[model samples]
Structures are given as structure tokens and as C-alpha cells.
Target: MQKNPGAKTIEGDLEEALFHAGAVPEQDRGCPKRFDWARSARTDKGVSAVGQVVSGRFYVDPPGLVQRLNSILPPQIRIFGYKRVTASFNAKKFCDRRRYVYLIPVFALDPSCHRDRESVLASLGSENELVKCLECSERGRKVEGIMGKRNFDSKIGLDVGKLESGISSNNQDAGTTEEKIKDFSLGANNGGFDIEKTEEDEVLVQDVNQEEVKAIKKSDFRYGEEERERFNRVLQYYQGTHNFHNFTTRTKAEDPAARRYIISFDAKTTVNVEGIEFVKCEVIGQSFMLHQIRKMIGLAVAIMRNIAPESLIETAFRQDVDINVPMAPEVGLYLDECFFSSYNQKWKDSHEELSMQTYAEEAEDFKMQYIYSHIASTEHKEGVVALWLHSLNYRNYPDLRFINNNVNNDVESLGIEAKDGEK
Candidate 1:
């Protein structure tokens, strides 16, 4: 469903591979075929899935079916094994819940990693470079006097004037030099960034496009303990049922499908990949629309980076406020697993449990070498997250400005504040 030119999708690739393996007859390969293929979840083009389940009618005449499929399928995709299920089984319809994981470099959420470069760019009047990284919709409406530097009421929480002054004073001593500019574009940290890279991971640095590589070398950005904790807090905002019309496309607030229940959304742990530290954020929900996971991650990251206020998220769930939330890159997102506990329980006596636990180790290895490595390598080269952060600052969504200027009223109207004794 996620389009990538000249690439093979799991659905398309599996359909063809089955044909080659003699499981799908040549006649069934055409559009008006007798068999139907269905997957538990739809993944984006670049997104990887280690525990995806697909159901289809297959002819299991001969032995070595799994071996034959593997031999014909590409290396990137492999079938661990299969089990015969009931005739009424439908992968998507019977799935109870879905889990997803997103891998993000430490620097993406650490403001200190980007602060100095942002200051340098501002000083050089080259801030436009950051604004042009992505296409964002202008909200058109503006709050009167919100654009001017003003002291925010302390009762509402964040002090805008003081926050601005603090950042300015801290960076006042930061000097712009030709070398620093060069290093800024290349994301080199001068002993400040704390991440380490392996020798093989370092190879991606060479031959990177000068234009694309022109970013604050973020490797030096230290994603300390405090920063990680704060980011986790930011992620907790999406942990309940909410209208997520803004998080995906072609959906309106009034649409019943826009309402989704999130079981848990949290930053579970950090993993070292090719010397770069990536935080693994896992999300569990009953169902998700297209781009829902990516947009949720994007809004959370934007809030963490201070490009958007925390209240913007609450406002997005309001039916009247339609904010164009950004979608995070698909490279880091993957379908971790799907659950069918209810179905399995009812048929415990007959059918084997439909689960990926048997192949968990192989799945982890595939995700590490193929999925995680590709994410790290691509991020190190393209700096997609870094560029996206810059764009968020310039996007100027009306809801962001509205909430910033009227935090108290916004919170009161939305009723997002916790009831007494709730937290």
C-alpha cells in the first residue's frame, strides 16, 4: 500500500513467490483468481515486518513447501513456517491487537544536539534551509500578537519569554566558524555528542550527498538520562482512546473509524546499532489507520523538540480543531506482531496456536541486520529526522499558535487536565 517505485511489496512479492513455489496455480495468479490473500496489517513500502501474518488458500500437495517458498522468495522476506487453520480464519478480521516499534536515533529528541546549529543558521540568515526540508500546510489563520515576543503566564506552565531568553543566553557564547559550519552540515560533534559508531557503520559517511548531508553533525549530541525520561513522558500522552483523525489521511473527526484505543505507548528501551543509540518505542492498539503510528511518533517528537507545544496534541483530538499532523518517516516503523488470543482460546482444543513465538529469534535477527541496520544507515546518511524537526518549526499550524497563546482556555475547553486523584 505504501508506494515505492521499482520495489517489491510483501503482498506482491509473496503472491509471485507462491506461484513459483507451485502453491498458487498459474491460473490463480491472475486478478480474477480463485484464491484470496489477506494480511493482518498493512506496512509501508520501506517499513519492515518481522511478525506479519498472511492467510491464503494454498495447495499443499507435496512436502518441503516451506523450503520451496524460501528458495523462491527473496532474501529480505522469508517464511519461518506455517500451520493449517480453520476454513473460517481471516487474518485481519480475527486479529485482536497489533504491536508496532519505531527506532529513532538519540539525537532526534535531544534539543542540545540541534541548538547550536540552529543558532548558527539564524546568525547566517540561512534558516530557510531547514524550513524547506518538508512540505507543510499553512494554517492560514493567526492569533493576534502571538507572533511577538511576550511573557507567557506562569500559571499555564511553560514560560515562553523566559525559555527564549534562556536559550539565547546559553548560545550567546557560541561562535560561528567556517569549520563549525562545515561540521554542522556534516553532523559532527566536537566532543559533545555521546554516541559511538562501529567501524562498519562509519562507512556510510562517505559519498553522502553534500546537499543532503548538510546538517548539524548530531553524533556529538548527548542523549542523557534526563532527556530520555522527558521523552518517555511525552510519549505517554497517546496512551488512551482518542479521536485520531489528524494522525492519518482521508479521515474526518466525526468518522467512527477515527476513534482508536491505544493500550500502551511507551519508550521501552534503547539499543546500540552500528554504534548509534536508538530508542525503541513500542505501541499497542486494537487497530490503526494508515499513517497513524508514524504521525503519533512525529507529533510526540515535535513536542519533545519544542517545535510544538504539548497542548497541540490534546487539541488535535478535538473534533473542531483539524491540525495537519506530520507523519514520521516509514524507515523506522515495523509491524512487530499481531494477537488473536480470543480466537485461540475458543479453539484451543483443535487448532495449533497462531503465533510467531517459535520463530522469535530468527525474526529478531532479521530485524537487526535488515531492518535496524537499514534505518541506522539511512538516517546517518540522509538525516531525515533532523530535517523534519526543522520543518516543524516553520510549518505554523494554527492549532499550535492557538494553544501557545491560550493554554489555559485550550486546556479548559478540551478537558485534558487530569481529574483530582487521577494521576
Candidate 2:
């Protein structure tokens, strides 16, 4: 029952609608005076929730209440139906498990979809050459922005002589792509949109270009069984409980909270949305931290693309190593369901079971109309996955490089120095 924070939120909208609907007393609206409002789960900005539940004391009339509230709320926010719970019921504490679904573009998992094969070859060539490629790629991005997008081939106009001379002169002082990624702040908030209403009408989100949009739609954008199997193998790494301190921010490896239990995580199937194909990944876990789900998806993509080795997943779970795991865009993530099995088992005789089954049809319709539609439209227009994959190549992970070297025998040909034991 607090003052609206200007930007629209589900809870904020609910509170306002309840007050206007006479479901809650106007006086009991904020701070100590407000009714206790608890949500089953909280999602970050731009993340949608389909089966989110809330509980609190309200002056509900029980008849026409859902319709009355729907009239006041926005099109995206809806009140399906309400249930009377026990006086001591708390939505947050009583919730046992949460399920989240991530819709990732097939191109993000299919290495063959990447347009910059030449850049990938150059990135693995030598340390200095990697730096040059990153710099040239940055410059090309700026130019692409100014002139709009023409063609991917036209953008790979690198001056070999000038780049070679520059690399020779600055080899000792050249910075890696890792430094550029930090400076550009690509990993912050895992690239989620921050919606703060300003004096001007604007929505802050990741920058997009027509070329990237065209790039995503240009190819068949389909993956074969081999690619699907690889993506699933990468996801399998996150199935068990692990120390995921590196997956999110601020939490240290020593902190007990850093460890999260993932009951299961898998790529369920490929979904065709409009013309683009998406890999539907479903994860069931006790809980997830900020940007945790997105980072999981990001790291999986990194492994699938060969930018990072599969073993890096195991290494990241260890306390000694702190990896800067990239975050996927927030558009595709949504809260699928919340479980209250314990409470239902205990209180079933007296009160109704706290389940979303009654509203399953409504939830699916809502997701199709609002959540899925938004994700598909955003991907088609913004090309969030393609752009994110491009930035990932700039990363120079030590373990990844080591694994690449071990697998490829042409280290000398690529200008990388052989180890003491190697020929």
C-alpha cells in the first residue's frame, strides 16, 4: 500500500486496483498502515510471470471482484480468481519450488548460424591478432550504427598491413577483448531492461540495428539433431546443486546462499514462433538469484558455440575460479509456476489446495497473448541473441583457450607458441 514508484509494476498495479475497486480500505495503503502483501516469487524488471501468486488480508466482496479489478489494471495484468487461505498462510515462505522457462533462439545454440567465421578463425590465431579483431569489430559496429546496416560481408573490411604494423608496435601494450567487454559494460545486469519512468517518454533497453534483425531472419535458422544434442548436454551441467557464485553478482563463493539446487534443467523442444525458431528450456529449482537463469543460458550458449569449453562449466562451480558469465536478454525469461506441495498436504482437509491447475488455461492464454508474443516480437525486431553471441567472441577465457589449443594441432600455424613439451 505504498506510493506508486512512477514506473508500472504488477504489485503496484494490484494495490491501486484494489483500492479503487473497494476491495481494500483506502486508509490501509502504505507502510505500517498497509495490508501485508506477499508474493510467491519476485522477478527482475522486464521478466514476466505467468503463475505468480499473492496473498494478503483484503476486504473482498467475492462477487465480480476479478472483473472489477481487471477493469482497473492494464491489459497485461489480470486477476484470474482468488482463493481463501488459512489465516497464517504466507505465499512466499510456503512456496516450495519454482519453475522458470527460457526461450532462446535456435541460432544462439547453432554455431553454424554465426556470420563471422573469419573472425572466429582470427580470434584463435594469436593474442595480438585477437586484440586487433576486437578493435576492428568495435569500429565496424560504430560505423554500422551511423550508416545503418548494409551487408555483413561489407563490414569485414580490415586493412591487413595497417593492422599488422599496429599490432607489431603495440604488442606489449595491447589489451585483450576481455578489457573491452568490461569497458563496454556488456555483462551488467545480464542485459535486462531497466524501466524507470523519466520526464521524457523513453524505454531504456539494449541497442538494436536493422542489420542484426536481418541477420537472424536471413538463414534457415534451424538446427539439426546433433546441435540439439550438444545444447542439451551443455544444459545437463546445471541440473544438480552447485556453487553458482559466478553466475550472478555480489554473492561470494563462501556464502551458503551461493549454492542453489537445480532439480532439473533441459532443452524441452524447439518452438516455431512466427518465422523464427526457439529452443524452449525449462528449469525447475528451489529458487534462483538475480540474473541467475539468464547467466545459465549464456554460459550454455558459450559452450555450444565452442567459445568456451564444456569443462568450464565444472570449473565455474568451484570456489577458486570466478568467471564473468554473460547474461542473456530478459525478454525470453518468465516464471512458469510456483509449488506449494507442503502446505497443500498439511491443510488440504480444511482449505483448498494452493495450486494453479484451476487457472491453467488462463495462464496459457496469457502467456501466448502477452509473454510469448512479446518475446517473439522483441527477438525479430532487436536480434538480441545474435548481437549477444557476437559480443561473446570478444571474451578471452584462459581455460577456453587452453582447451582449444589442446584440440587443434596447428598451434604454430596459428601463430600461438607451443608449450615446452609440444612440438
How do all models score by TM-score?
A: 0.71, 0.72
How badly does each model clash, as a count of residue pairs? Answer: 6, 1
Candidate 2 lDDT trough over 10 residues, lowest sum: 162-171
- As a whole number from 0 to 100, the lDDT of residue 413 in candidate 1 is 55
User: lDDT tens string, model 2, 35-152?
Assistant: 5667777766667777777777666554565667667765666666666677777777888999989999886876545435455466565662321222123322212221223333
After superposition, candidate 1 runs with Cα above 4 Å error:
1-7, 115-224, 395-398, 402-423
Superposition error at 354 for model 1 (Å): 1.2
Candidate 2 TM-score, true structure as reference: 0.72
Superposition TM-score, candidate 1 onto the true structure: 0.71
For model 1, what is the C-alpha lDDT against the true structure?
0.59
Q: What would the per-residue lDDT of candidate 1 be over residues 1-423, giving only the tens digit for each residue?
A: 222356544556566767887677778884313565566777655566766776767765466666676667556566766666677777778889999899987767865343333333564555434411111112111111111132222121111111000000000011222110000000000001123333322221223246534441323455567777777777877889999988999987789999999999888589988766888999999999988999999888777766677877776776655576867877778778788888889888987787767666766666776667767655544455655554555433334434353533544453344333422
Model 2 RMSD, rounded to 1 decimal: 15.4
